[model samples]
Target chain A: MGMLIIIDQPPYGTWAGREALDMAFALAAFDQPTSLLFTGAGVNWLRKAQDTADIEQKSLEKNLAAAPIFGIEAILADRTACQRYNLNSEAMIDGVQLTNASADLLGQYSQTAFAG
Target chain B: MNQLHTLHILNKTPDHPRFSECLGTLGPDDAVALTENGVLGLVASKALGLVQTYALESDLSARGLSDDNLEAATIDYSELVNLTLQAERVISW
Candidate 1:
């Protein structure tokens, strides 16, 4: 298993931002140690409430809630992104650790994959 | 070649600066995987020229990109997976 990093989010709109997390889960299924970093509008994915019934998409909240079970311990959220979006940490998905997008966090991985 | 050790996976369109910017940084030995929106580069190979490109077969077909348009580089899913294994590192954008 290799380092699997995902950053799936756009500046404004749709579900493309969730692709990174989906890929991360797929990678985890292969026994890879996965990490996720949400930035820009991607941070909205972590917000506590999400319902896909309207668009006929599967519940996104259901998918994100399983990260811990998949062995993904690191879920980094950009502090600036949260501020820009006016999203509070308390409203984020459970088990996700929020933090700034620091060099140390980014450099820790060998490869960085963006899903935007 | 030692330069081929790094495989850069690009998922944006040719219009994306990341495509040009990433290409400029690539050594002659690097291999590129055109997936998602990056397949647009294949459509304009005449101007972009040939620089060792490969399109994810599944993605290209899913997006309705035919072989005729993929004059630059085209490969199947197995080839894409194999390239990743051959690479010392895989960077996706």
Candidate 2:
């Protein structure tokens, strides 16, 4: 069965967003079909210009870019969330699909997980 | 069958309660890795008593910590990826 993880928190300020991504990778490592959907402030994780050096935190963007290597093929962002944050596709990492938050889209998965 | 293992990635400093709390949940066969500020946990001379204990090399250097002073093995990004793949579940604290 496929698992969809929905993340709604921004990265770095709190550990929730990073922890959620870790869960997705962990599930994928166990041979479970896993996907991630970024919404709300979570969409910031996809931005390519994140500079964590001043904050002394490791870059979450680097980890997000490595998602594909962990067997997580589906990385998505909520369309409205991008507009809400004024983020364009060019500003994000390559290959993160953008889609609306629709029930039909969510229903495609066997189980849904969230870290807020 | 081989038992499933859980990998605990601690990204917080040792001063945080979750740092110690996470250790109690580890199985004898589980593994732990300290990254980011969590690498500070190794400063204390306590034995983790797990199958393995690791500290991300990049994080250690970023924080100006010397891997030579740590009790855990130093790992790179590739090893971090491998550790996650080797575990059935991962908890970041």
Question: Please, what are the lDDT tens digits per residue for candidate 2 over residues B46-77?
Answer: 75645478987766554334423566899887
Q: CA shift at B16, candidate 2, in angstroms?
A: 25
lDDT value for candidate 1?
A: 0.65
TM-score of chain A of each: 0.82, 0.96
Candidate that scores best on TM-score:
2
Most accurate candidate by lDDT: 2
Q: What is the lDDT of residue A95 in candidate 2?
A: 89
CA deviation > 4 Å runs, candidate 1: A1-4, A8-15, B1-93
Candidate 1's displacement at residue B70, Å, is 47
lDDT at B24 for candidate 1?
73
Please give, for residues A45-65, the per-residue lDDT of candidate 1 as tens digits: 665545443224555567777
Show where candidate 2 strays beyond 4 Å: B1-93
Model 2 CA lDDT for position B64 = 37
User: Candidate 2 at A96: error in angstroms?
Assistant: 0.4
